[model samples]
Target chain A: MKGIIYGLVFFVSLFCSSFAVAIASKPIVVASTTQIADFARQVAGDRLIVKCVLAPGADPHTYQPTPDDVQMVLESDICLENGLHLEGKNWMSTLATDAGKPIITTTDGIKPLAISSEGEMVADPHAWFSPKNVAVYVNNIVKGFSQLDPDGKQNYEARATLFLQQLRVLDSWVRQQINRIPTQRRILVTTHDAFNYFCTEFKLNANNNFLSIAPVGWSTGAEVGGGMTPERRRKVVQSIKESGAPALFVETTINPKQIREIAKETGVKIGGELYSDSMGPEGSAGETYIGMMRENVLLMVNALK
Target chain B: MRFLLVVTIWVVIVGGLWGYIADRDTRRQQITAATPMDLSVEGRFVIEVTPTFSTEKDPFALTTSDSSVPPLTVKLNGMYIDTHTQEVLRGQTLRYEDVSGVLSGHNEIYVSASPPLSENTLEHGVRVKLYEDSTLVVDQTVWADQGALVSGTISFNHSADEEGSHDH
Candidate 1:
């Protein structure tokens, strides 16, 4: 009877140990934003556990990291952030650095658009606006995952390749859609200056004017209600009038009130909201990176064309 | 009999613990062996643009004409790789190391000049050098003004040894 008891104990211990090892084997990936988390998931698949610091639709520019964020970083094997000062006060970097965790900047390789704000030139952190830049983000994510879990290199690379193919198709499709709109009417006005890369990629800025004509500058960190200066407002208004823009757009992560006012002032209807700073909530059409880009383009073409 | 029972229980526990630890270590070793080292691409980009007078009667009338010298910018795989706004009278060389977005297969690099590389610009061109593991893999140059776009692809076959050693 004692022998049987010992045998059962041994089997249970073995099972429990195996379970622990299985659970611990998968690396933990902590991403600073929901968009970064989505990219990580695409590359990591089941190889890593991806956690996002900012929830969907959360304003990253003003987000403050909680104590739990610190703990999460401590347990994370890798942390990914959409660098270029997108994390407001650099909370993500601070957390990762404090925990000695490896941090990967998803925007590391992409050329950032520079915007002049309040007499300072700042790099726009919204590179994900362009599908081409998202490809860069995907590549960086794959590299980061492979480094963290070298055993999963092939897996990461495979997923990245598949996703990149989709992006290439998406890029061509975006071009086709944008081309439907006449060159003269290809103006895209939004609430903030987040669409520079998108416009540049699609050739919407045909005149080479650096104005993505928005009430807000490159960042929302400016004082409340102070982001839209008289100069910016006048420029946006002038651009809208000169370009004969048909419609305007707001963003998911910002208040629609400002854009609505602009629309009212310009006599151009609010075309629709675009997923800018953050992607849409889960189960929505704009949830994934590709979906968000597609939806934004569809809205633009439908409205502008 | 009690002592015997105690010894048996202790032996069972020890065996169980030992088996658990050994299993974990084996799994770890398997993972370590299976893990593949990360691969990255590094290279240098050089651009040389020579000012040229336009054949047009009025150079300022050309829409592409700029009074000030335009900056040289480059894009890799449709994304901006670098933008040198500072004037380069003779030429400029830019080095990129451990660029993370490089794939195991084909990669594209594009070079362009702002204010548009005009036809009149003489001796304006771009040179690209790609390296893998510190070994030169690609050395090519294309005239920038001829196309206003100089592009190339560098292919990396990382699993060459496993498939049969090959260089690209």
Candidate 2:
């Protein structure tokens, strides 16, 4: 009887250990940016572990992946990235490719704005400026998560639907707020050309040639002021002078010296600091993507109105 | 009676050990053999305008006309798989989830425009990429004139080990 009791204990322990392992195991999902990670968490919930490579307030366009990021990718079951060269030097792509992990580009289905840099037209990578575009991001994320874990399809879809409804409400609210400002006063002058999608969606451009006039170009690479050439500067100054923009605004990720100078040159007061390249830091009003966009629009309306 | 009891206890011990080892091996095999259940297909389409006049005469004509012209768009009219049909605009990326059992050896994607564009209205091209899990399997580009129906085929076995082929 004693030997039998010991054998039964051993069997029960082994069975319990396997069960514990099964319960604790969850797929790891690594997102390239905070915004993408937030979206993944909304859809993934408790089904997967979501991690972000770029922390809040980190500029995606100039971010570099560390060796730790490579190890994280290797261990991750799936990786998500905002393609369209948003990772500056394509560091996210390089990390995922090197680690042989599956990667989903969150901006896979959104229509991008074409901005001219050095007389060459390039697709603007900042699609999340508009809530409608973020809806597309949510959809792609749902598909990615469902593919990674088919058993969680219903869970992801349900969460995505709820989030998408919130986005629609946000879009409607933005339109209503912007409507308060006069059509001619809808011009948004920022440091970089990141608000083209916002301008296009809200009909805020003065003309097709100049959509959301800015001192800097679309990206902040090795090029001076993100390819802000002398000609481009002259054009922006001319546009501001012609349009008589009410105010100029700076971004969260970029330095405000250049925009401040532009404001001084144009004699326009700095409206407010807007979240551009990256969202606001934790514990702030603009910490989440939705919060960031709402704060930006409110600031724009109050400044431009 | 003592001999029988000892033998029964030994049998129980041996059986428990054997069962534990077999279960561990089975679980290991299950983990090693697991494959992804879906593949990602992503691509973009662009519409190009072909001018009927010379550059000097119409240097600003295209620009002026484009200003009057509405935003040009395209749609995914159909796919060989029934569930994958959806609309995609020009200059926008399209990503389709090709789940297991929904895709087969050969698949076709058909594109069409609403209200039918004229032959000289615009020219369009498509670039598609297929990925099995994270590994790129195939990439191809196809072009067609305005008002012409555009279609492309992607071929691959359902097996996770096989790479897909994109025929333009």
User: Candidate 1 residues A1-305, lDDT tens each?
Assistant: 76557666766787899999998877899999988898889888987989998888888888989998999999999999999999998889999999999999999978899987678999988888777688778878887787778888888878876676566556666777787898888888777778888887778856647346564332355542347777877766666666567788788887777657767887888889899888899999988988998899999999999
Q: Lowest summed lDDT over 10 consecutive residues: which window, candidate 1 chain B? A: B56-65
RMSD of each: 13.3, 16.5
The segments of candidate 2 whose C-alpha lies over 4 angstroms from its true place after superposition are: A1-24, A216-219, A223-239, B1-168
TM-score of each: 0.61, 0.59
Tens digit per residue, CA lDDT, model 2, A146-230: 7889889888888876676566556656777888899878888777788888888777965644376774332355642555667
After superposition, the stretches of candidate 1 with alpha carbons farther than 4 Å from their true spots are: A1-17, A207-211, A216-219, A223-243, B1-168
Clashing pairs in 1: A150-B35, A150-B36, A151-B35
Docking quality of model 2: it rates as incorrect
Report residue B53 deviation for candidate 1 (angstroms). 34
Worst ten in a row by lDDT for model 2 chain A: A215-224
